[model samples]
Target: MSELKQTFNSSLGKKLIMALTGLFLCVFLIVHLGGNLLLFKHDNGYSFNMYANFLTHFPPIEVIAYILYLCIIVHAIYAYILTTNNRHARPVDYAVHTKSPVSFSSKNMGLLGSILLVFIVIHMGDFWYKYKFTHSVGYKEYRTNLLTNQTTVTDFTPQTADFEHSQSFDGDTEIIRVKDLHSRIVASFSIWWYVLIYVISMVALSFHLVHGFQSAFHTFGWVHRKYKPIYEFIGTWLFAVIIPLGFAAMPIVYFIQSLNK
Candidate 1:
């Protein structure tokens, strides 16, 4: 216990924790982006709601969700602690301001991370809390004709008194789907202000990832003369550019679709 405390109190230990948490979040981004892409199915939210249902109902996934929540909290808190420590250690300004070899994103990680944290809270409150804690406003029932193979969706609203009983299925023939969430997402994105917020937040996320991905490798002592450039390229293209752009695309696409309607 004493040794563990000593390590955690040291600079390297805090960095290792950040690296591990950052890598875990990177994996989460891939999974989350894949799920978000389901919004483009044009199925009136059946696919997306079903995906959301599976995430919340699956026992293993629920456990993982708890861990993911913990990781987010710990990562943010440690980041604040480390930033404060660094600032305290350098209280005195240099005699002359000099250009830093580190990139701008690298120097502004704390600010970028703070922005991302705010975005996460808004995101979770908008979706996760509504879906998990409160009853869905209603669901859509998708019915198919057996002979013609034609499909139709009907909107449903459960009795307020029986809201707790609302589910994704109504009976043997009716396939009740959660439409409330899909409607919420679409409506939220339709508003110009909301879409603007999303776009700006994703830009901040891109900057954060640009520095964080490569910094994680440095924290792990994995950076080498031969592999440094390769790491930088991967970090720039995959994490910094591709991932954020993928996320940013979702809101933009949906907002455009909403405009068309």
Candidate 2:
């Protein structure tokens, strides 16, 4: 107990914790983005709704979700503690502030993180809470028979009772789908301001990742002469630029499509 407390109280331990949690979050982003990209599938909401259903229902995934939530809380709390400690350590600032070699994102992690924290709250309230706690109005699933060129529509809700209740279908053309999450996404993105907020938040996320990815490695003492440049490139280009661009594309594409409709 004493050793554990000592490690946690030390500066190095706090940084190591942050690094591990940050990397975990980076992994979570990739998984989340992959799931969200299902929104692009042309098949009405069948694919997306089913995917959502799987996520909510699967036990292992649910466990992971809980872990993810805990990680977020721990990460945020530690961040605040570390920032406070740093501030207390340097009560007197330099009379003249000079620009350092550190990137802006590195210097302003707290600001960027605060913005993301707001975004997460809004995002979870809008989607996660609605999907998990509230009753969705249900959605329609369309099935078309290639042989007869006949189309059939089925409606069902995402509530626990309704989701458990099964419907019987005799014809091959009949396909039952639950609430259309894709439509919900489209509806949300249709609002210009919502899209703007999403875009701006994504930009902040990009900047955060640019610094965080490399910083995590630095914290782990992996900053070698030969590998440092490679890590920087991966952090700056792949994680920072490519990943966020992919995420930004979802909102932009959906918003544009909503405009045409």
Candidate 2 lDDT at 77 equals 90
- Backbone clash pairs for candidate 1 read none
lDDT of each: 0.83, 0.83
Candidate 1's C-alpha runs over 4 A off are: 159-174, 225-230
Consecutive 10-residue window with the lowest summed lDDT within model 2: 159-168
Q: After superposing candidate 2, which stretches have Cα over 4 Å from the reference? A: 144-168
Alpha-carbon shift of residue 26 in model 1 (angstroms): 0.7
Please give, for residues 119-167, the per-residue lDDT of candidate 1 as tens digits.
9999999889877786654566667555565568787765553343234
- Taking the tens digit of each residue's C-alpha lDDT, what string does model 2 give over 1-261? 999999977999999988898889989998998888888887776668778878988999999999998888888899999999999999999899878787899999988888888888988888888778766635666676757866665665454644532334556565555655667788888999998888899899999999999999999999899999998998888789988898889889999998888
TM-score to true structure, per model: 0.90, 0.90
CA lDDT, candidate 2, residue 91: 92
